[model samples]
Target chain A: MDGWLVDLVAKYNYWIYVVLMMIGFYAMIRKNNLVKKLIGMNIFQTAIILFFISTGAKKGGRIPIVDYEQALAGAVQAADIVNPLPHVLMLTAIVVSVSVTGVALATMLKIYKEYGSIDEDQILERVKNHEP
Target chain B: MNHNLPILVLTFPLLAAFAVNLLGKISKKHVAPWTLASLVLSSVASFFVLIDVLENGTFKYTVGGWLPPYGIELVLDPLSALMLVLVSWVALIATFSALPSIKKEMPGREHLFFSLYLILICGMMGLVITGDAFNLYVLLEITSITTYGLIAMGRGRAPLSSFNYIIMGTVGACFYLLGVGYLYLITGTLNMGDIARLLPPLYESPTVATAFCFLMVGLWIKMAFFPLHGWLPNAYTHAPAGASVLIAPLMTKVTVYLMIRIIFSVFSPQYAFLIHGRVQTLIVWAAVIAIVAASLIALSQRDLVKMLTYVVIAEVAYMVGGVWLGNTNGLTGAVFHIVNDALMTLCFFLVSSAILYRFGSTHFKDLHQLFRKMPITLCVLVVGALSVVGVPPTCGFFSKWYLLLGGIEAGHYGFVGALIFSSLVNAVIFFRVLEIAFSSAGEESVPAEISGSRETHPLMIPSLVVVAIALVVIGINAGSFLSQVIRVAVPSL
Candidate 1:
């Protein structure tokens, strides 16, 4: 049982990515409101952020750095090295995703103001009216 | 900075978006000229990069002086350079066309519109040039976000159309990011070159196959290929004329470029070719379905803009099918069509927008006998329509010719049938519009028609001229010059 728990935790990162992805996708597709959909998009993008960040996580490893004691003793090696590159990339991706979400939300607000409602169904109705 | 021009191509327009925003408060008059200047500068930068790549072979410039396999890299290969030129040239012409239509449609938001437009161009250019897979995601978001804004800027149903686009675009991007995550997990790299190097050894791995499927599906959605094209028609039809002209031409084609990059650069053709023949056959049949279904749907649409939107779906399938044919001729036709279709669609959108501006609506039934009032715009539409329908003198013919040759070479006579069917459908669709243009509606006095036409700003003429010249130039030189560039690009894939 103890070993089983450890195995689950070992793959904890991927499990979180999968759950978050499902939640985000459900929110985007199942919700009818526009702001809710935008929020869903945000959640969806953040799941990706989580995935990238978690991929950089290492088991029982310290931050990648030069330590004199470890080097002199020859105690440290590749096994304990943590990757910082994906963390940096995730930082950029997070920023970009947030910026895109902000723009999308702002556009949604504008859509609401122009149409007087934010419901997708109502907007579609009004659009049909406009066409005819 | 000369060797670094690809990065600068992205940076200049981003900076210009901000500059346009801050300066629009001082005076909105400079928005058009400022946008034009920014696009021209980008065009010049792309030209230099193209020349460098063609002359010196593939040049990879890593961001911040970091070498590839470790740091981010920007690749200036023949394919990217060709796409860069196509994107910037369309952008420049679209900017010119957008100016006049924008003034009439969203006079209050010209600055914001043009700013987003330039930023959209920058995102596409960046997406094409960057050799980093993760970087493409960032750039894709930039383009997708700006696109939502541009679509929202249209009147009436614009907000709804834009909202639908946002939902679909986000899902598409997230799907792509998920695929990127899968790739990173297996290969432990985000750079295309590094991924390419790592993937060869892992070609048969199930994880790699999953990643490939995920990426292809994501990109197919983004490109609006067949089944995934749900959000495109409304978005294109409801967008403002200016936004329609700018985006309809290049956005999906850039996504197609990304698909090519993922297929060729990240996963070498050797590995992809090794995939079971059954998979290739499945994809080819899917493309055929897209071609036939989209054309049939297009035939039923009454709105000209909406009809054109469906036709785009069909056209995308043509390229997708051609590429998946998995032969020299197929790949060449697909890549060449990428350029040809970009020009052809831009021409069509420009003329369509011109019609919208002059007539106040794009309804097929409403456009009776209005051709005499705006002869120039009508004539432009004629040429654009002819090109779109794959007429002999237009560039569309050559791409279709090559695609047909590709189909025959691949022994997929059904694909050739689909191609011919789509061309015929396109001909029927456009000719219906032309017939309407010539028909005599009840004599409404010329003054009212002129008043309706008065909404057009001077920029329309110049934008049409740019698109018209591009249509003819690309059509004529497609055989010798452009085909050669596509040829160079194809061998690398």
Candidate 2:
């Protein structure tokens, strides 16, 4: 039991990330409304962005930028700073996520205009009742 | 300067997209020439890169002058170089043919359409050439967003269908990003070669296993592998003919190429097979079902475009199953099929778009005696159909032959049976269409006499003829591709 608790605490961030991802995944697959689906997609993207950000964290590490005096004296230690690669990647991921959401919203507006409602079932029924 | 050719091949399209969009304000006529010139020039650049690869294998560079594990890398080997050239040529031809459809379907959206078209090309080329996993996600989004824009431009039900596509595509891309996050956590690197080296020790770990599942499933959804193929038919069917002709063939093939890259490049086949032996078996079984199920669904379809989309799904199953068979023959078949299927599907979709243009709808009932009216288009259709049915003297037979041999060598007889069954099913589907087209026009119920003019856009006949000739040419020369390129490129497990 103690070993189990220690293991859970050691990898707690991953556990939380998985739970968050499952929430977003569920909404994406199960949501009835198209806007809800778009929201789910954003949530899903955010979960991934957060996961990348989590990978950059290190205990007791400072900002990744090199200190001038420490660098000048050749005293900077690799472990003294957190890994910044994931952070840089996450920044890009955030930008991509924003772009996707913007496009998805625009697409949703088009759907709403076409169907007069964003509910998936309603739209499907309407399409069946009418001709493409 | 020549060493920078890989990045140059990719950057030119991205810049051209911007240039075309801006130039549209000056003169709308410049859009087509600008788009074609860019793709043609990039194809030239990519060909130089391919020649360079044949001379000195595997051109690799670090972007922005940073080292591996730190900067994004650009790579062009035989496989990616081949894909680069094939995609450029297909898109160029598709753009040339799109002239008629663009004016008819959505008149005012040409500039926007051409801009997104160029961007989509950039995304696919970048996806193939980029060596970093995160960079792949960004490129994937670029492809997805531009695709959604172009898909929404169709006349009827297109907006709704593209909306459905946006939801599914974003989910797929995010899942891939999540998988990349997991790898970065464990390997501390984003460069594919660097991660492939670091992943061996962790192959047995649950984390790596989960990551592999995410990546495969993500790509499967994007490629619309049979079960996850819900978004494909509607999206492709409703999209403008121009967009369908361009994206239908390349999008799924490029995604499948990415899957092969992940399985054989990033994970190393030994580790992937070790971890996914059972999963790969399951996937092969799933693929068999996909082959039979999609073919059956296709037979029941009245919409020619949607029927071909189903065929696309089954063809994807062929490539996916062949690669996972874990043999050199299977991998070769899979890679070869990507090129063959892309061209054949492009040709077919091109034919369908021409039909839509001439007749104003894709319903099979509407097109009778089409052989008499549009001989060139019908001939192009026949050539493409023969290939899809796996007939000899066409490219499709050779790839399916390799796939069958690989399946037999792997002792997967069920998959072998599936392949044969699908070929027969495809034969039935295409032959039925032929009979409908060729049967006496007197007996048919509807003549579709409204738009009976034989003068299809002057450009259409030339493009179709070119693709048809290329089909037979590729079939004749497939032996060279197999011996010279594919044999050397399949990475050893």
Shift in Å, residue B142, candidate 2: 0.8
- Model 2 chain B: weakest 10-residue lDDT segment is B443-452
Model 2, position B295: C-alpha lDDT score: 94
Clashing residue pairs found in predicted model 2? none
State the fraction of real interface contacts model 1 keeps: 0.76
Runs with alpha carbons beyond 4 Å of true place in candidate 1: A1-12, A64-76, B442-456
Candidate number of the best TM-score: 2
User: How displaced is residue B380 in candidate 2, in Å?
Assistant: 0.8
The DockQ values of the predictions, listed in order, are: 0.64, 0.77
**Cα-lDDT of candidate 1:** 0.82
Tens-digit lDDT track of model 2 for B368-407: 6767877889899999999988888888889989999999
Any idea what lDDT model 2 has?
0.86
What C-alpha lDDT, on a 0 to 100 scale, does residue A76 get in candidate 1?
81
In candidate 2 the C-alpha lDDT for residue A118 amounts to 86
lDDT of 1 by residue, B382-480 (tens): 887777778878778888888899889889999999999988988888888888879886655332233343535567877777677777777888777
Q: A-chain TM-score in candidate 2?
A: 0.91
